[model samples]
Target: MSDAAILCRFEAARSIVRDAADLAMAMRPPPGGPSGKQKSAQDWLTEADGAVEALISERIGALFPEDGFQGEEEGRTRTGRLRWVVDPIDGTSNYARGRSRWCVSLGLMDGDQPVAGIIQAPALHETYTAVRGHGAFLNGRPIKASPVTDTRSAMVEMGWSNKVPDGIYAAKMAAILELGAMPRSGGSGALALADVACGRLDGYLEMVINLWDVAAALVLLEETGARFSPFLRDGGLDRGITLLATAPGIATDLAVALAVPLD
Candidate 1:
């Protein structure tokens, strides 16, 4: 597709994702958390997930009938060279508990390349958008990764997944502490990576994460000059896999410490 076409879709997605996030906020659970079901040990599922996905799918399908659509709640509903991958409510656990950390994420892919993306956190009133070759923005202003080179001064977040064994996850967390950096787990892979892009955090890693989780943030990271693992090359296009995205300054050392390669 031409650059114009890509940018058109990107802009449309921004509006679409923002509306979807508002829909999620309306269905958000109360402060003690909703009575959500578990997809697994700690994985959460809420009505908002499917509701938001359906809204986005319907809107996108109506706007771009030929474009493919994929969602976390509903798998691929349509197929095309230009595909849109979405995580309707990225931090279900947080959203389910009435927290403000969850978001609605949508990414555009041209074949295997992530060309553009939009991540909207309605509860926080923040929106991040990026297009390959263009810059990344947070609520309309440009943003970039942090310049902290020393691991001792960095703050990194590691996302958790049930696919990883407890012992292995602990070992990786210990390794980050060994490097003298603070470690955190925000329960939202997309936002953590966006934090890396906008310099709120120095880096983000995950033992196992799905494409929809990072699809939108990947474009943001790339536009902001952050270093990350070769997720697609490592089979992220087809299944969940390990991911490590960091500011360029801490990328090398962090990768070595975590034993996860960077792109």
Candidate 2:
């Protein structure tokens, strides 16, 4: 598809997500219906996640029915070389708890590389988008990663998967803390990456993440000159796992500190 047509498709997808996010924020949750995945001792899935995915999937299908789809809530629909990876409600846990850190992420990938991306947080009124070779933008203004040279002065974001063994999780956490940088944890990988793209945070580390979680923001980061490396070659929905993304200055240091093996 032409770049203009692709951008139009993304705008439509973004609108659907904005509506879903607004609806989710307005509705009150049922008392004691479900808690976080940690407390529940199971992966948490919510009605809002499904609702948003359905709306987004339908919109994308209407625009590009031949393109494949892989969404967080709904299953995959593989068909064409161009696939849309989506996270309808990226930070479901935070959204469920009324935190404003979540967002909707959609990425268009040709083969294994993302070519176009959009990340929108309706609650925050923030929208980030990037097309390969076109640079990244936040709310229509272009953004770049911070030029912080010293790791000690950096504000970093780190995330851990509940599925990781306790020992590994602890090791990763301890190692990150020892980096002597300010570390913060939020619920959404997409939002965290968006922050990195806009220079809100200097870096982000995650033990495990599905493609939908970082697909869109990955393009944004790249366009903004942020550095990232895949811990695994296969980052499809089925093989989601470790990833490290950071500002260009600190990418190597953070990767080495985390001991993320090189390909």
Candidate 3:
């Protein structure tokens, strides 16, 4: 597709994520009285997730009825060739607890590849945008991953999920420590990946993550010249995928430390 076409979709996604972020912030309930249910012992789902997703689906449908849809809250709607993937709130636990680590994530994918993405963290007052060939931006300012090349100097963020076994996370974390890099978990994958785009974090790695969580950030990583391993190598696009994103300079060592396949 033409660059203009990608930008057009990017603009639409940008608007939707911003609107969803605004609505989510306004509707957030007090921590003690939060309206949410446990999708699992460790997974959470809030009213904001469904509400924001419903609004995003409706709004995107209005503008692009021919496009497909897939959301963390709503599942799949294969209406057309291009699909708009969304995660209304990436860090539901943080959002449910009134923390500022949540974000609204949206991506436009043609087939299995992301072409455009937008991530809005309202509480943080930040918006990140990216297109396939165009560069990435943070609050409209161009951005890129950090230039840190050595594992000893790279400060990386690690993402965790209950879906994966405890031993897996332990192994990866130990490897990171052994490599002599600091590892931190920020509770939001999309936001963490956005930080990588803007050079705030040197790297991010997760064993298993859904498409919604990383869909938008993948585009940002690509446009900013950050490197990441292919997600869900063993499953279809609808299933969970392992994710690893790093500044180009630190990618090799980090990947090696984590035992991620470089091919």
Report per-prediction Cα RMSD to one decimal.
0.8, 2.6, 1.6
Candidate 3, residues 205-240: lDDT per residue as tens digits?
877788988888888988998888877455537688
lDDT of 1 by residue, 33-147 (tens): 4558888977899988999999999999999999999898889999998999999889888887898998999999999899998899998999999999999999999999999
Candidate 2 clashing pairs, residues 3+ apart or interchain: none
Q: Candidate 3: which pairs clash?
A: 232-241
Q: Which model scores highest in lDDT?
A: 1
Estimate every model's Cα lDDT from 0 to 1.
0.92, 0.77, 0.85
Ranked by TM-score, top first: 1, 3, 2
Return the candidate ranking by lDDT, descending: 1, 3, 2
Each prediction's TM-score against the native?
Answer: 0.98, 0.89, 0.95
Q: Give the CA lDDT, 0 to 100, for residue 77 in model 1.
A: 93
lDDT tens digits, residues 155-255, model 2? 88887667678798778767767877788888788999889988999888787788888889888888998877753265544676877778778777777
Task: After the best TM-score superposition of candidate 3, give how far the Cα of residue 218 lies from its true spot, in angstroms.
Answer: 0.9
